[model samples]
Target: MDTNKVDNKGYLDMELLRFSTAGSVDDGKSTLIGRLLYDSKAIFQDQIEAIEKASAQKGDEHINLALLTDGLRAEREQGITIDVAYRYFSTPKRKFIIADTPGHIQYTRNMVTGASTSNLSIILVDSRNGIIEQTHRHTFIASLLQIPHVVVCINKMDLVDWSQEVFEKIKAEYSAFVSKLNIKDITFIPISALNGDNVVDRSENMPWYKGSTLLYHLETVHIGSDHNHIDCRFPVQYVIRPQSVEFHDYRGYAGRIAGGIFKKDDKIMALPSGFTSSIKSIDTFEGEIEQAFAPMSVTITLEDDIDISRGDMIVRENNVPKIGQDIELMICWLNETPLKLNGKYALMHTSRECRCIIKDVKYKININTLHRNEEDKNIGLNDIGRISVRTTTPLFYDTYRRNRNTGSLIIIDEQTNETVGAGMII
Candidate 1:
């Protein structure tokens, strides 16, 4: 291997973990994120100076860490996060993307938006408050979204006198509640986000706790098996045909791998068309590769000239996705406008886009209580509900559990062109 090879291959190979921070009001979610950024030295001098000045203006004794993430003027003025704030940083071992979502009950849609792409979730709980309704709601959403890992940080441990008993009590309560949920791989840590205890470094104050620090756990968590790599699925987003004088015969289908793997000369079939073709070559900007896997973006060329376009799927013949016009999914209504019964909207799944009508509203999920409200068919803003829909054309999809990328879709308002809802096929 060349010692100083160019390109982002090394960075690409490094583990990239996207995690979301969620909690109720005053749970220190923003402060925790600020602490992580500050401890990791991911903050710039200007940013630190700006926050320091802001902190002084607010008459704080110490530099306010929460000022780092609460970037909006309104958020700072109100002292509350109102939207999904994204931050990026990297450790020596792994790169990280943090989605700092709003904790208010009305902003549940924002939490869903932030957690949708997260591999893990850091749910902050004030040690003084233990587990509350918001805690249950956040945990339920994490499980519903199928986050691979979860870390329940018992924050404000300093205020609690760093008591092991308090930590254990909260841990037991959280564990018992999650037992009723579909969540797996949960970890507990006692930390004072304000004091930087057991965040980036292990806390000397809590010597009773022997687990790894938050950063260490985040850096080393195994996420290799999180992606669906068994069933090959690719949705062609674009058809590239460079009509130039030099080598004008090139025809390639461009898309990101939604699932499984693909290689040169692999037998593949195009969905809706029922046409079969063999992969001639897999091309990328960096040169040809022997194989490509899930989440990778590459252009594929078929040996035979077949009619394939955007919304068309190229998948392994043996592992075909479900093809149908009717789909039942759990949708998180995103817009302020209530989801109209029998209303038609533009549904985009993978690269496929089609008009879909709401056929029936089965039930709405009460995120706080984790109960199904079968009697209520009205899904308003931030409501999670099970619904049935019919598409103008058949969709090729897998259940959300099987493939996150291929099994999810967005509902778009045709008139306003706004994304109104996000659905996970069940």
Candidate 2:
């Protein structure tokens, strides 16, 4: 059985794609999202009726499309997205999980959170506004997160009369800015989320435009190679021992493969203790499997009896990750309180856990302009910075750009237990 065929609702088969939307206030970010859902036939009848009624109540001639994604009561009232609201929709080609993020400067952390797990990022720019500060900031964040693909959506084309010059100007300005960043693939599209142009279907108005529709591009983009398939890194999350008489002798180390692929009979080594073993079998809740890949949780029985527990890593002999207590990281401060110069915090990386203390604050990065401020001592809310940390135990990891699942981590305050920061290993 192909487990990937089962949907969350168990009614359909769809391949899931996680994506994030980013733009400044009034850039039509929410409106674009609402348009996608509405035009794609993903919105419910009740939801549509409610929005229509609200539009009439507000004395608007047309229904407010932005209302569809502005879910919070405060957000709806303020006409802005304050937090990340995840929306689910599906097309025949694929299913989508959208992380609708806020665009306010104070909400940079929210955008980072939303984009962290996304395979692609849709950056909206107002055609009349061209490439502005917020556009630069969002694009920088997408680059910093190492998002695999970026689709620059020049929105509100109708506002600019669908002028080809307007689109070309914004495209040229954005292209220059993105050239400095480490973005992999970039595409530009002219769209009017309000008018349903170039969103789900081809636009008849823009005859000069010859690009795929936004939905078409998303469904066909190659993302199969986004995951690391060479370096095997599995951090054991739990030990599964079926006490039932039928499986009394079964002892399995369970975890989601963070990188690479694993198969039965492969030679593996458990880290920290340096014990060697071979995978006797791979098991899932459904049944045993011949092989498993990154992001899939499975249990492995070893041919040799080895002591492996939670927080330990199972890796291939030749492709082991860095083993060290000292690590350098590019961290984004997510809290309002300034990062303490020598503060101690709990670090959670994959299934491995440990406590780490900040050794130094290297530099703070200005996201909008890509400027590095080395003299800054404070890392307050929504600030991106580089810092060195010393952990109680060695962390087995790779650079975040190589394997997002294995290379990323979160830091929590010991007293409040609040996630204070998110970091990508350097």
Candidate 3:
């Protein structure tokens, strides 16, 4: 049986796949998503009517599918995506969370945020325009974030009269450029998101093209090993202690597992304190589970009582994370105010918070070209750069490439209480 044809309802369990879409402006990103929703019967009748009425009011001949995702009034009026619009739908094989990111260069922060947790990236290229600078920028960002999969949707094939030559040229050009990137798995597909060709169903328009539809590719892509399951690291969020008579002795450390497999009777260590214990049981509301892994929220009881608290970490005794007060990271400045060398800010990593001082700005990156700019050290809004910082307390972390949850952080301004920058530990 083809699992993709199955109905995704309460009866059938499915894995959730998170993906983000990126492209240049007017490259049919929103329309592509609309087509996916419409053709898959993911949208409700009310939603279809709403967009239809909106299209009529805007004097559009056909229903403006873009209106489905361009939900903000400002975005609809301007015909541009500014903020990241998240959409949810499900096929029989999987549930999907789509982050429809903005296309403009200045909104790089938004794109980064949207793609940060995505397992795959769908980068649309206008068949008429070919590869543009925004294409380079978006692809580089996806590489930098270590996205596991990338599907280049060469869109608007209908405009080019479904020319295979144009598709081959664009694919060749893209292949040459992506050769310099760190992306491991990439696939190219010709599509016309507006006409619903090669989107939800294989396009009959292009007999020369042979590949799975975008939805089919998404449903079957191998994402089972995308998460780190070798190094065990769990940041303790809250300690549960119910002193009720029935459970008076209950003391469980609660957190979402950041990495690795943790099982009952597993030997574990608590960070900063360097205390060791053996796992007693992994508990959930339903019952006791024998094991837990990354991204799963569970309460764990240990055999030995350890002075574990929020900001502490539980890890496998043998494969632990780096502990230090000073580290280097690539930071994307998110605030209007430029970063100041030697300035103090509050840094949050995992469930830990500490004061940190900017030690030095190493270099800035020209995202499009991946070139380092050492001459100008000023890290401003949307600028990605390597910098060193010293934290007031030691942190337990891994390189961001190895573990996203344990290695990413946010810098907050003390006075303004605003998130000024996002960083990935190197």
Candidate 4:
């Protein structure tokens, strides 16, 4: 099993699970990721040597597995992850993309950025600490982002002598808090990432626990239903015109499928320009696929030569997304500057872009408490708020919970051209 030469076709056929790791500082977020990669033999010899040398320099008796993910120089020195670091690894069963997010309260925005696209989230809880505020904060963010599954990894069991009582207490408390959220699935696993207990291999120490290891659960979790396949949504990112002599008349609309199944000869409507056409062909580099679904990029040619371009969407005639200029949604303020209700910012959704003004500040949520605060209408950095946005053009969109690709948007500050906010439409 040469890892580098992992069967390309087999890997392509295997399911990909995008998961994010989150926890408070010193809670072994990076260590757990490294453990998964190491125990599964995903790292190369050079990587192992580099980790060993780095560990020895740090005067660590054990291999500093955290070094695998904390790649930044400042992060290595400060011993705190300051930014979202992405790591990719694969097993026989599934491919994985891990978003190792920061745990500090100030980096809530970074956590959101990391977890937004994740199908699952692994929140580490130090057994000694039980369930803490950061745990609540991360869970709330996970719920807000509509992450389908959560794994509460009660880490550092070695410090607590592998006590089942400690693990149960933390799990019970966290479950009670999560019941109020929209999270559909939750699993609790007790492990010591540093000691390599119950991360990849089953731990002999945890005979009392019968649950599968973290990697097993990750490989087997039901993610097929994670995508929204009911609503047909495709935002045209580009209009392709072939210049080659073989196909000079070729015209195809290019973009990733935002939602639902798009098949050949299906009746489609181009958005923002209400023209109707049937799909002539769904083209990919590997030839035309008979059908395409969410997350797959393809070029579609229409039977009728209806005018279509970037910022336009192709959707099924029925159950089309609502088109409107006034949109209300929950937004997380990401910039250092406070949100201005009067300010006009550039709003980008899918392949569409428009100038939008924050018409009104609805309310901000207290992340830890999961309660809405209306009196304090000010939305500052890292504050989660509901706001009214009036766009210059009508948007073909769905709620974030329904279609993440079409429902999520970013607000960019026009002056600095910086992304100021992230919004999930209600």
TM-score of each: 0.94, 0.94, 0.95, 0.94
Global lDDT of each model?
Answer: 0.90, 0.88, 0.90, 0.89
Clashing pairs in 1: none
Which residue ranges in model 3 land beyond 4 Å of their true spot?
1-11, 60-62
lDDT per residue, candidate 3, 1-426, as tens digits?
Answer: 233554524427788999999765578876788778766677889998998898899898988777887878898998777788889887777889999888777888998999898999999899999998888999998988889999999999999999999999999999999999889789999998888888887899998998888999999999988889999998999999997999998999999999999999999999989999999999999999999998899999999977899999999889879999999999999989999999999999999999999999999999888799998899999999999999999999999988889989999999999999999999
| Residue lDDT tens for model 1, 1-426 | 121234645655667899998865577776788778867778889998999999999998978777787888998998777788889887666889999888777999999999999999998888998999999889988988889899999999999899999999999999889999877699999998878889987899999999988999999989988899899999999999999988499899999999998999999999889899999999999988889998899999999999999999999888899999999999999999999999999999999899999999999999999899999999999999999999999999999988899889999999999999999999
Question: Where is model 4 poorest over a 10-residue stretch in terms of lDDT?
Answer: 1-10
Worst 10 residues of 3 by lDDT: 1-10
Q: Rank the candidates by lDDT, best first.
A: 3, 1, 4, 2
Q: What alpha-carbon RMSD in Å does predicted model 2 have with respect to the real structure?
A: 3.2
Which parts of model 2 have CA positions greater than 4 angstroms off? 1-13, 55-61
Candidate 2: global Cα-lDDT? 0.88
Per-residue error at 204 for model 2, in Å? 2.0
Model 3, position 354: C-alpha lDDT score:
97
Worst 10 residues of 2 by lDDT: 1-10
Expressed as tens digits, the lDDT of each residue in 1-426 for candidate 4 is 444355555655678999998875588876788778876677779988998998899888987776777898998898777788888888877889999888777898999999998999999898999888899999999999999999999999999999999888988898888899999899999999988888888998889999999989999999988888989999999989989999898999999999999999999888978889899999998998999998899999999988889999999988789899999999999999999988899999999999998899988899988889999999999999999999999999999988889899999999999998999999
Report how far residue 214 has shifted in candidate 3, in Å.
0.6
